[model samples]
Target: MRHDHHGRTHRLELDDQTLREWDCTVVASDPEDGLVLDRSAFYPGGGGQPPDQGVLIWGGVQTRIVGVRPRDDLWLVPDPDDPLPPAGTVVRGAVDDDRRSLLMRTHSGLHVLCGVMARDFGVPVTGGNMEPGVARLDFDLAEVPAGFKDDLTAALNTEVTADRAIQVRVLPRAEAYALGPIVKTATDLLPPDLEDIRLVDVVGLDLQADGGTHVASTKQIGRIEVAKVENKGRGFRRIRLRIAD
Candidate 1:
């Protein structure tokens, strides 16, 4: 396994977005909790994207993994009552590929929406959330003009058809900050001791500090339809979106 600057093992999935399964050794496990693998392909949910669902195979038994969360280390929470494999046990982990693919599409679609908004409206995202086929992004805006939804939807689809390549990179925290990556949360929310940052770049479109899975290209996002736009409060508005299959 590889190690990061923090002395922790480098997440294998982070290095290869397309990886859906991996062989790993169990670092720890519990009957009530779940297994902690030395290396895991499951993303321990964060940054608005939910955790991955999968299964672990060990000792001629298959255990369904229903949830994952981060403690001091990433923990794979299997379905309730699932037996736990002992530490050092070699296991195979597999992510639900279809579900993960949908998440990647939805996540990338949201970024495309962000790019369109920033380019056309000069607004930054304040917050957001995502699921398999849908997502919503909150933006700092006092008001939107009539027909804003239709216009925004058209622009988003245009970018999808443009098929810009999506790129991911790791950079020094200072350099990333200097590049002005779009952040939905407060800057201070980022750890001060963070020496390196992962940046997602929608080439020629958008660049942001993000740690979620995404497709390789904008065309993979397909058509994005605006479902609703609600005014959350003064200077805050939310846009909902769905991807056409």
Candidate 2:
């Protein structure tokens, strides 16, 4: 199945892009190092995180994908400096699994933090990004007491112990809005339409309309630590955090 929009070609699969290496047929090829696969899970990164970089293999040739750019309903990337594959060639595209897994973990971890902050402290997330071992989120707040930070950290670690299932699903736009106030502040990257919306729900904890890879369970995120909280504006604060083991 293919749903092409916003330079997103294969996101309809909704599987972790880096971990699973699905063999595919190259429906089309470009000598300028451009190629298109019948299927892919590569995250042409968004939500502030940079795009993933890795390799694509076609029989005896392996080409690096250094940059990812989106145009129309397709994502474009260079096929590294290597022999070209003619149209109708079969190839296997893979992303850096280690980096992608870390990103998935960190991205889901942020949701926990965001949820905890929203319920306990009434601090909603403004924006955020996740790296392997480091991540930061922006929240609207006047001032955050240190005690609250420690409590927040403790709360997040506690949730990891429960090991909640990280559920992902797509809902119609009206159904999404029916999620009520919890999703009020979360961002929806989906195109505005009468179509269904993709949502990541932390099973009984938090839910948000999103379009990124995530861990199957909260346990994979382990413990999350709120490392630092900086005052970005008069009433805006940014919290930096990370997930471990």
Candidate 3:
């Protein structure tokens, strides 16, 4: 029985607070950084955006975030060099505000790109990464026109200017599966519990089973432009974008 704070709640204010429900409490430390928080608003870095970084403080000890990787069902934070306190130790967990914010906005922008592409030209995502300033996504299409890049750039900018909302929710896996099958390229990341699923919806644009943290609105993403589109292979094309004002 696990869940994330999304559809059930509104007005995610941890945004203004520099913390996403960080509190001091006793938790049994697991080898895997998959923190079993009584509750966590911090998404475990999936669908891009990378893992989160934060400090876990206990008594006089401070354990910096080494790697916040998600392993299927659990998000693991491993202390390879220094061993964390014994299980059941009360500690404070803090998320890296700057990193988290950037990741959030970048991730949302990726969705916006997908939505617009799907709506206008029928492009679906093959892969993507929500890096700090630049994001990249692989699209499956052939024979891009010379003006294709400019056209897409302008269209995506229009989307960010519109500032649509981005939504994240955990739904029953069976229910999510009922929505549709995972794109072949994304099948590997599919949740084990077809009955329990995570859904990331770009309000009126795009929606899919995702477990990633994103901004509340596209406005938070500012503006975007296609930096470059590389020819990966026969039918795969890579698009690099820059987030701007």
Worst 10 residues of 1 by lDDT: 1-10
Local error of candidate 3 at 57, Å? 2.3
lDDT value for model 3: 0.66
Candidate 2 residues 63-160, lDDT tens each? Answer: 77765665543444765556666768777877877887888888888888877877777866677777776899888878777687788789998888
Off-target runs (Cα >4 Å) in candidate 3 are 4-21, 24-26, 30-42, 69-83, 173-192
Instruction: Compute the lDDT of residue 220 as modeled in candidate 2.
Output: 88
TM-score of each: 0.93, 0.87, 0.79
lDDT of 1 by residue, 1-245 (tens): 12231123247767787998889888887876677787777766777899889899989998899997677667778887666889889999899999889999999999898888888878877888999999999989877998999999889989999989999998888898898755644344676786788889999989988888889999998888999999889999999999888
Ten residues in a row with the worst lDDT in model 2?
1-10
lDDT preference between candidates 1 and 2, better one: 1
lDDT of each: 0.83, 0.72, 0.66
The alpha-carbon lDDT assigned to residue 143 of candidate 3 equals: 67
> Which candidate number maximizes TM-score?
1
lDDT of 3 by residue, 140-184 (tens): 877688898999988888887787877766667667767764342
List residue ranges in candidate 1 displaced over 4 A: 1-10, 184-188
Error of 1 at 117 (Å): 1.1
